[model samples]
Target chain A: MTQVSTTISKEKCFEQLLLGKTVKRVPGQYLSGSEGWLEAVRAEALENARALNFPSDRHDDWRFTDLSPLFQHGFQPVSSFAKLTPGDIEKFLIPGSTRLVFVDGCYDAGLSELGFSGSAGAHGVTVSSLVERIGDVQVETYFARQASFKQDAFAALNTRFFEDGAFVHVTGEAAAPIHILHVATRREAPSAIYPRCLVVMEPDSRATVVEDYAGLEDGVNFSDAVTEVVLKDDAQLQHVRVQRDEKNAFHIGHCSVAVGRGSVYAATSLAFGARVSRHDLHAVQMGEGAEIRLNGLALITGRQIADTHTRIDHAFPRGKSVQLHKCIADGAAHAIFNGKVIVHPGAAGTDSSQSSRNLLLSGKARIDTQPQLEIFNDDVKCKHGATVGQIDADSLFFLRSRGFSEERARNLLSHAFAAEIIIKIPVPSLVESLSRTILDRMSGVRT
Target chain B: MINKDSRVLLEVRNLRAEVVVDGVRGVEILKGVDLTVRAGEVHAIMGVNGSGKSTFSKVLAGHPEYTVTGGTATFEGRDLLALAAEERARAGLFLAFQYPVEIPGVSNSALLRLAYNTLQNERGLEELDPLEFEDLVLEKIKVVEMDASFLDRSVNEGFSGGEKKRNEILQMAVLEPRLAILDETDSGLDIDALRIVANGVNSLLTADNAVVMVTHYQRLLNYIVPDYVHVMDGGRIVRTGGKELALELEARGYDWVRAAA
Candidate 1:
């Protein structure tokens, strides 16, 4: 028996890069010249492993939940690819937006259509593949100067291995909205798709972007995605992400948003599937009078598991942020919520509040919620609270006594619990559709 | 004595119940009670606080906590003891609760829809969808003079004492039960609310239905006159008379009845 070790030198890295370069001239893109990004990812993965093996005993963050089920199975990188046609793209397209299709982690130009008018002129908007813009000097420079990657392991992995994603740029005076619909279809066997989205809004610009992750069939798959957004002075952006995958899938997504002076940023995440899923959202208010609003909704049943971890950082004076996350868990499913708000020194006049509420329908269902606040400045107003409880018994009995059957009573209570947040959505039809879907998932328990 | 040919709507025979306290059963509340009500007539039962007036009402509606040791109540010649509380409601037996329960997050309109559908189902009839039910409920809301806005609010949540009682009468009006039992419906109401509730009850009276008014005061009787007034004492009807009995009881309190007993 013998053992062999393989080592790669710096020259090997350059050779591999040159062999993979296909574009003649790199368009303006992010994360092309960052050497530290790849190194940071490797370190974060080791840290995550250590945290899993030996958790901190000082806090009760993970007291109610057991993480052994997630680490039971080992996952592999995706290799097999699925080819998608234009008709397939049309079948899965969202009603109101331009489509950007990615098959097996590779961008397909023939399957994607961008730009409202199909014009090449610069009208304060640009949409293209990351591979075409990776070599641009400006994109490389911006990637180097922004974001800290050592805290999150999945973001590091996406930064290191994501081949091609979507790059959106809005000019200073742009007014129209740009919607980026990212569709990921699973292939045979255990596969993975890394969707990286970079959105930049110049000064005085306004836009909205949506990222959607879905599976085509029932299979063991993984979706590792990261989205970075930069809003310049007085700019506004509304970002929404939806993750709906098969029961055998694993999804890890991260969203990092940066806001400048007097800018407004709002982001929402809706998770309804995947056997194991984790979402990390970080928003930073860098200048005075910047505001951020983050809302999240998750529905879990069966043996599914979903964790949402979010943080909002206030670095300047008079910055405000509010975060609300709600979860409904039934059967043997488990849900986790961890949200933190940090107010740094000199960040006075900051008003921030965060609340996480969970509704457990079954005795076997479990939820762990941790809402934290770290403030250094005394003048700031910050509050955080978390609550986990079963549905009110009095309410159930009242409904039942009113001629609603037992099943109908439970269904109405569940709908009313989840609808408190769903009704906040601006679109009426979308809210109704989501409400109906939630009710259907709940019907099994009532029956 | 109940008239045999008067078309009996509800008949209770030998109804015995008890109040369980601290793992030990206390004195019997309703001890071998017998009563009968005829359709198209209004009956009033006036009693003191401990006379088991409310207990009899709750027992008939099949509240789970109250134990029925030996009893049988038949509604329209059907076994009422075999039915659950909700089943009893669907079988045309309405009990206006003494303390109407507050149901948070459930709108009044939605609760009415469920009640309407359950009644329809028990009758083997087709159920109305939301659009049609809304139209039907809006027409019935006027019977109680309820504001249309109340339909959007949660059931009895933040409602005043008078409003909750009025809400109960409103439900009874919409349900249109064959036997309507008002258990202290005038407990917390002012003069105005009592008049409105009494008017709503009067509007629902018909030859095919009956009303059982349980009260301790004669004020409510001044508005909705009763055909028969029974004085209940120690879980039994000690005296029975025409509508003048209520006036006599008002003039001379329960002391005269207790002295006679």
Candidate 2:
């Protein structure tokens, strides 16, 4: 492990970074298994962070957001914690499937329970800590191949640390969905938790997994995590992520999925918490006859800021993908969405579309949406659109004329806007719960 | 003194309006039109496409696109022009749009409740909660003979031409305005849907309320009879006659009336 020395004060990390001074990179402390990809990831992290230089208020992309929360608290590398126990695992289980729990930055075996009970981890289903599986030659080759460090800074940071993350392998003919629950428990101030999950589904396999980010207490905590997904030929995977943290927490995460030939991948991301949270998703259809569907919804209130950036790359012919993301911004909060669909030169038969719509509840609330589509192949069909506006006044008047109060009218309109996306979620129970949460949030009712 | 049975519900004297566009200027669309609709009577206004039939309804509804340069409308002896569009709606005035706007995220039932509650508040009546409101709308849904699923769908979204018109009548049934103005309600319906919509309107009519049906054809009048039919051209009523006037226009066509006038 290599440790770099830093001359800047802990409180001035963001300021020094903004000034273009080369601050010392954090120590590379691999947990006995990430040696192969450690050096490459660390170099990439330092270069990317230097390029970003801690965005200021002048940056148009981030002008509406106040980044003071990131600098108000310092960052510390967290690896081992004593608060999480086996009992906590029972309360966090997703019900009806296998559960994997990671506390702080290390995978806790005692805190995880496999649902099969008497049956051992069966054929084509391999779940273990990343440290235990890094010796495999396949893991070494595919670690940083699907994920690029230049596109996202947080992914680079998670890769540089290269600690113990979850590694699940689904071999040929696997049917069941692998559920990975990444739980972050905060204990001290200015603490950082870097938890990562790497999933590889082999040919002719199917699986479902959930990446949950939550905080048990209210503290000044930071969670920087990344998940990399690779699907082999004819494999299918369903991924659902729920982000609900403390009001004072800062969370930055990324999910990168690469699909193979004749494969299918569907993912849903529901973001509802964190003072300053951002999630970036990058999906690449690398083979023919590959399909992907992405559905995302965010309910924001208070002074929180949630941003989601997605890029779907069609690298081959006969690839199709659809992305729909909706946001409801209330209070003084701001929501940002940037979705881009690109068709490479040889991807002739690609069909892709993306739409982003936002409902602003107050005049002071803000929403920024940008949908971009670039096509190098003329034979392909692609469309992209974005809309950001307040609730329709005529519609409100029309509703009010029927006898609804001001509050009831607002509630119904906001709920319907969010429900358009929520109803498309595959999980019925989660959809119901999310709808209730959205209604409650809009009505200012406590959960 | 106004007779008890002949009490006037709506009165418009020398009503003049101009169309405003681009915030720069305006053009007169209504030139001193006079109209009086009494209770227990249905008034039919027949006019050409650009004869300001729709504009008259919008002006009465206080649409921001049109400015009333000089006019006075007394509804139940209250100044109608002083109120906003929504205020007028709450004060027992309803205008069924020629083309109902589709609100993508608002459900039909929810919109109806909002209108109902706003009218209640204006009239000093109690408001109904969600459960009670749903029940109220369910009864009206059956009266319009609309499907139960239509209540859950978005307002006018993906509705067929007939369904949209029927939804407008459903709204009329639920709101129960004292003076209902149907603006070109029969333009986009087939024979069957047209009969259904006209029947829905006829069922809602009472001795204490008045209706003003604006149409370009006499097809709708075959079902919903009008007590008095007015011929309007170039922004003003040219002639007034009995219900048989619609039949006479249907048999003789509009050119004969233009020739006779």
Candidate 3:
């Protein structure tokens, strides 16, 4: 059996993904939006998506991750939404919390539950669809503002075609969390779905938002998502994002956040599934005396590939940021992490630190981790480190000497490695559920 | 106190072992070592550095780095060499490491409870729940005079040198093994810590258990009061006598033992 290498040009690849040649799945009514302001933005995004070439291994940023597997199979838009009940997604529903369910990138009003009068809650918080709140000033002002798609092809594609997503606006305080749940269903043919989210936190307001992307079945699919977050003065937002797609799926997600004066933005993102997954997170501290924290963990095995690229920009003086990202790759899995923290020239008195720690559980597993720090001011304090290693030999022997079987010892160490990030999630139930998922994944790991 | 007719807890005859040294294998560390430990006996094997005192203890505990090229070891008439490390642990053999490994992110209480539960299952006994086990751990922490806050921290992470050794003793108190090997357990302890650690080990001794302390200094003998002392020279036990021999070794260096051998 000879393996053939087909060198398809980037222009042809883009044409195959976007041109109306494969399959047109969305209904005409779903594509029409009342907001005329978005039409120009969508048009601009379409042109950008066409002009920019799909990144290849030659691209320095995408050197380790390959996109050929995604292009190998043609994906059609999800034509019809799957019929799902609350019981069908019971595991995803946070008890008594407001939730917005999107099945195959199409909003499912029947499955979503909004407290107070449908989408309007206490403390002047509004959790509704972007299309429904088209005329709102804040939604119109903040949507498609923070996440720039002119340079990123995937982000551009999501901007050009996303039908509907959640629009969350907090005024005073939101005690109950708002969950944006994206559930991918098993499709007859390989499909592509776009999920988008926009969050705006008002001055001195506090809220917690959980963005979860999960699948109902282990089927071939593509999830291209973009989330934009903006925090005003003295605001605090605890954001938790989890990606648990199907085993044979492809996921490309980008989240860009703009933090305001004296505000705080903390995020914890975890990835567990998907044959090939990539997440690009960018947080810029645009205001002085602001604090930002970004924690991520990727637990993947088999031939899975999980790539995480993050950048924290301290653009203002007296800003602080802390980031810790970890990965546990088993089997022949590959995990990549690139964390860059830039302290701008005028950003004096900036205190920032970043660390990327990875664990390889097998000889065949691979990890490429790099911590890049660019400091332009000598008055700032920045530290960064990276480590890629197997499980500690002495720790393993210590557990074994305490009467734990070798397999159990390995699982415990791996669980502890992933739990350092899981314990930071503000939701208790989500932490418990994610812990069980990690343990189940690590149980089958031989090393 | 040594009994004349008590059960032979651990018996080793002509034990030979080798460990890799600087990427080279088959470097014999323990050569022709023989020893016997009866129930209720505390024996201290004193040796200079590179004399393979730690090697002999690790060999008995089934450390994977050491290959037992020849010889036989038995615990209560069962073949100890054939068992794995954890198997040896479940068979009531415990070795207190000189440099305890610090495992970050694993709470000390979690490790203790899991190890205790695993040993319970091995003995066909009921496992303790978290609540029940917390009560037991609180009581055991007093044996080593450890603060309760240590249980909530990661296992041995950022612990001071003396504190790490005491943590080892705390684990020993929790497991209550039949035959305990203290491998250089007194290397880094201050005077007060030495007393507390010695008192902890002394209190755990019973008529059905034995202890083998491998050390270079005789100061620890003043507190634990071993019943017998053996001087190891060139990977072999050259002299064996009552505790008075430790005092003699303190008076004269180990060179006398090497010359006598």
Candidate 4:
């Protein structure tokens, strides 16, 4: 066997490619965060990014998803936007409560509304950005606490190079949902955008935060995003992440969450676009009785590739976690799903399950799924499953035998398969839109 | 074909059809089958297994697997073979399966309404809203003696054999197709379920519609009597007789029928 070292020269490294761009920080936006926290993390992340190579297929975490195509191009900084319009942002805007709109990796003040408060203003919440908040000890802990970028390159790049990030903190009281839109405008040069988000749900508070990602279909673009979520004791947070970028774009995202004692955190991601996209999600059950649910749906077509990797760490006793991720690959599209759940010692009575199901519409389309369970203590119930197959011929014929056309039968069945995860999303209004997006993005079969 | 003088609802003339072999060349299943059904009549076709009893029924309904090599099938003077499966259904022809496929996450009520609404639109009739459709479905469930909860559950998913057969009968009741074909719907049903399914078919029968049943047993005919019985051998109807032919064949067996043909 040949021993190969995972190393890269300075010219090919992501840090060298993305480091020289000047980033402007808009002050006074983050009401409760610290800028020094970001600066402190950036220094370490830059050092790590410079010394490490971008993750290749040689890496176990990225074995199925290839990043060579992303490495070929030298992405410039996002210094200019060819087109940024209100209609572009408004067309995809889901009408609801409070929202923050970011266009081309910068906060769009005109399109944003920061009215996250109770009716009488007594239970008013702070929805700000990291560029505005002053440095403090608690802010530093939430910012740099959970997501360890020791072996992660994109995450380290996110820490060092984000233009700005979203901040939504619940002040121990409940309020309406906070919807954030991260829209990408077509840039003059082939470039990359790092948009980060932070959600800190205070103890005993309950809220929903929806992060929607979209882009114009002009040309190729690259997006690397990192989202950090902190849940205190007995807090409940429903996080919905949507990806609807250009077909020529490449997107990589990392979501890190920490669940406290008796806390509940549920997240659902609807990934529909991107030339090649991979989302890595991780959640740690830090305290006892913590519950976490992770659900995802990916529909890739043509030569597009979509992948999702998730890991749940059940550290304390009485923790329960469930993960269900599904993808439909058509044309020559490829999808990868890898899920792992670790039940450590003292995590007794832990119930954890992970399931990944894939559907191939055409003969050439393919999927690779892996579900791993690492358990150390007894007295726990844990299960993991992965399935990859075409649609059931019997089911198709059964529907076609009825009044349904062959195309309609495939659509209905495919929709039903993905609906298993979509319906689990707590947000009611998202159901119809997500359904339409999945049908729209599905390949091989025309609806 | 039998009964040329009657007002024919469906007429099949020298129907020769085959299914694709390995998605390419033809493997013939129906070899020149000729049958005719008149309005206000229920015709039962009985044959042994591998005799292509199910294929003939499927070909008439425009199943994509079966290709017509040589045939002229007319439903109400329209060329039935040229239409799609959904178009044939919209034109008031229904085929109840021997084994209904379970479609998970799609409720029985939703499927029924979709089929009903498509047919209604084809007929230029007013479509029923969800509430109105629910009321109609609840009323029709009694025809099959089915529980009201079945309407809300996923179509045929986790249903017993008897329940699936009853669900098909209930669909027949709601759709009210001009020609209803039951392809061995009684194959797996018990005596009580067979009676209920037959009763449901009987209730939907009218002077303007017709029924075609493909079965291997004479027991189904006991509940809802047939107007005529045809014995199929080698994909063609070799003998045509009244309802007694079914009982005679059931008692004597297919060997005698084959010998007689």
Candidate 5:
């Protein structure tokens, strides 16, 4: 293996990169005199990002995933927005949805359909660009509050440089699901884009949102995104995130959610593309009687790599959490999953369970799964399990004896392994589309 | 019942086989066994445990774990040992497993439909689509006394012992094989399940097909009466007789047969 070591440390390299990339603009008015606060937050985040070192193999969380392939390229920021027509993005659109489309980190108002207005104190819902809603107090209070950029380098970079992204605020029942689509157009040089989103759901409101990331062409690009979600008391939200970038792209995503009292939050994330990708998710129950369900699936082939790290924190009494994560790796691809559930002291009657299941299709395919649980109170109920294995021989033979060819049987079993998670996506259209994608991708899994 | 003019379906002569462990052959299990069966007939092979009754059925189905050292077994005048397990199934041979494996993701209806369609396509017959196949499988599922929900669930993933055995019979009904080998299909079944499975097998029998059941007890025979009973001991059949022989063995036990052999 070729070594990518350099005399200049990764921290210094990124510090110089950040120094040259930081930009300050005359910001829009938000809640009267909010411009100074935004700049201050940006500056402090940039400084914090510069002070921290890029994760190396020595880091406990970064031991299995080597970022040398991503760090080797010095990706430049996308200088110009690539022009795209309505037909160009027609395939990613979901029926009965209000859309917010962003091309290369820049919001395209012409391509977006906002069913609700951005006026202050909107009653029902508001789905618009983040930069346009700077006047809302909810945006100011919850924008960078939930997901801390102080320790995470990628989140800090996204906070410092993101120009515009989707902003969804729900005060009542939403009539249609909101779809936030981010597309990366191929460029001649290696480019980088930062995508940001903030969602605030008030008490007694309900809604569903989908965060979709896609690429137009197969080339090297970097997408660092951060999303903060706050579910207030008695609120319900279903979030589905799909990442299907190009084969050579690099993606890093961070999503932090705060669950309030009597609220329910459910998220399903699917990862299917990118040469190297990583996602970090954190959900904390801030009040009593909160519930959260997290489901994830990662399917990769060839030389791709996917890593997921998730933490669910139960801070109060009577919180419930259930999580399931699965990975299917074929060829020489690698997959990693680390799930942690922490029940703090005084959080009695907390019910939590987690399971991680992995499948390797080839002799060289690899998977590393870790399920961790920490219960400080004896009154809590928590359980976790991890399993890694290949196909069952007896099952294979049974199928063959029923006249199914070996290839067809293998494909059927693998597809069934992934359909368990894919079937849980709330949207019927997205579920069908993703099922087709998985079927097409799994056909190449056979040796 | 066997007709004198019925065509021969399976013929075995001086067959010898053994289990393979890590590519090495173990002790011989089926030592020079011989048997013959014709269409429209049901035969029962009775023996004590480890007498190679189950091994004989698996070896006939071309299970990879067991290797045939020397054998001459023909199915419908074709060398059965020369075909792959799947090819044998396509040529109309079915083995109801003793311990049916649970497939977690593949649905029962899906597997049955695929198996049925594959056989149909191989025979140059019309294949059914999903809707048509569902209709056909729903009809076949009733033969085993299984409800429609069994079609939607994973293939015997969480099924009970009896449910798994019935699932095997369900597959047999859908494939409609010409020669069916029931290997201890009644081992784990209750009294009701045994009758249901036996009745299912009885209903599927026709003038062109035959059933070979391997069981230790004669209780299953009360429902699906066998036309012939063969006593196997020490890896070979020592005696062959009519249905009364089964009742005699149940009364006298295997000690008499061993002493006579």
Candidate 6:
């Protein structure tokens, strides 16, 4: 057993659960209606899970963020949705919108529209729990395509334990985005949750998927999430994830996407909570003429830490990608960003640009960023840059001279620095909501 | 708006100040400087380079780097030095900075709205909506013949020197303060831009308000004539006279004033 952060031993944590030589599907899941091929796939996933290893600091991908704290707690899979009554999920819910709600790691049939009769069926969208939809036609093939448990150990861990998550298949175009809320309910024993989401868009279709994670602010919890997205030819998808987890919570989530030929994938991930969290976004342009935009913001304060690592690979010619991620850390906080764009050997005429900017509002606050471009094709145009600094002194004084208080001036300039990326979100209410969150976090923050 | 006994818009008495370096040592800039300006007047303080003219304007705005060792500044009989910089600005004192800052992401319209709304809140007046504010800002933008798109761009970012000066006047127009201190507002402006800025200042001048122009040249006086011109040397206002003093100081350089003093 590997012993780290807390007094609890690794045996007292995930050793017996995730590190087992041979893993089974979570003890009690709703997998009754599965057939031969789907059952065979599940058994194969379990075999793959058994061969996986936990990520450690020694690994290049996990070097910056430490998961020792996560390995110090004993967690159980939330077998059913009967753990807690659905009470606070309404506050996080967008009014009059179709959504799927998960408690701990299980989907609450009472709280989710997927369980209702013809709820989202008439809207040209299919919504269901992956447990029940494993044998269905649209979802059976797209489950493990993008986020390969065979490669990512954490994803392998989630695939072994995750029971219920949102399964959304959008036809033509969704009338309204399907919102997925993964709410965590803590117990006496420290709990770990693996939230999963699979969004598959049909050819020539368009849709949006919002994955929001919420939990008690002071609770001891852990969530490692995996979301796999597939955009078929000429399909467009806008995926937004809001992470406002518990303060003592440890969250490490990854979103893997495969952009089809001439398809567009736009994503924005806002990280505003957790003790230590890092979001990984890996997008691969699998076909020609694909376009992708990945933008994110992480706000950290106190002793908190947030980091984001993004990689966009141009595999075919005429692929385009734009990446911008920002981090604002105050107090004794730490924020890190590493964004890389790769142009393959034959992927000529590929245009890519990536920028990673950070704002340090306190002397003790730190930021580390590396924006890299690795291009093999000479004809491709690729650019990457990184910057880290404090607010402009002259701008602050200028605002103050115009009748803004010192605090107000700093907040306005800080907000402007963040809005350079936050305003790009297409949802109006979500933009306003996230703006208020950023402002509230920015209140009383100074350099 | 000037009536009998309109008001004493600004009065400075025996102002002594210095720039505190590293928060310890002090370099004396304004030594025993005394000045006064009433409503319905434009006072031009002419000085050679490094005569502490800019320091005096900044000190009035409560710049933190400047320390007022001994002095009292009054605006409408209220002690200005006792208030914070924003409070001083709210009390109708506006300083047109010599070097306007270029804030990359903040738009000009947003900056003007915040300043205008804050002033309205200070004075207990009704704030205008966005459309009304746009109309008001547009009306003021014409004073400098500024392009309408200037309001849409980031504040002062990438603006040419002439455009920056005109932007300062445009801000003065949007925020109609009682005392508008133009610190080198004429510097770096072309002849055409100088005329537009001078004309904007002339159009905004009211008998109930005042203007203070700190300049090194007499050319600006040719456009917006000053009622009084004060010569500053060795951190003191050694001489004061009518607008003719500006021409005299121009024809006969500031060396004559220092030699006579």
Candidate with best TM-score: 3
Residues B131-222 of candidate 1: C-alpha lDDT, one tens digit per residue: 89889888887877889899888789899998888888888877899999999999989998898889989998998899999999999999
Write one digit per residue (lDDT tens) for candidate 3, span A188-217: 777778899999999998989999999988
lDDT of 2 by residue, A289-405 (tens): 898889887788888889887889999999999998988888888888878888999888898988898888877778888888989998898887888877776666555444455
Query: Between prediction 3 and prediction 6, which has the larger lDDT?
Result: 3
What is each candidate's fraction of native interface contacts (fnat)? 0.38, 0.27, 0.62, 0.53, 0.65, 0.65
Name the runs in model 5 displaced over 4 angstroms. A1-34, A116-124, A444-447, B22-27
Which lDDT value does model 5 have at B90?
A: 93
Candidate 2 docking class: incorrect
Interface RMSD of 5: 3.3
lDDT of 6 by residue, A72-189 (tens): 6666554334445556676677654567888777776678764332354555678777776776676768776667778776677776666667888877777676789888766554
Residue A39 in model 3: shift from native, Å? 1.0
Cα-based lDDT at residue A268, candidate 5: 95
TM-score of predicted chain A against the true chain A, for each candidate: 0.80, 0.85, 0.94, 0.91, 0.93, 0.90
lDDT of 5 at B44: 97
lDDT of 6 by residue, B102-217 (tens): 87667889889888988998999998877889999989999989998999888898999989989999988888989999999999989999999999999999887899999989
| Local accuracy of candidate 2 as per-residue lDDT tens digits, B6-90 | 8898999988889878664488888888889898889899977887888898788777678888979999889999987767787
Q: What is the TM-score of chain A in candidate 1?
A: 0.80
When candidate 2 is compared with the true two-chain complex, its DockQ is: 0.21
Q: What are the per-residue Cα lDDT tens digits for candidate 5 across A293-386?
A: 9999999999989999999999999999999999999999999999989999978999999999998989999999988898899998888999
lDDT of 6: 0.82
Between candidates 1 and 2, name the one with more favorable lDDT. Answer: 2
DockQ of candidate 1 is 0.34
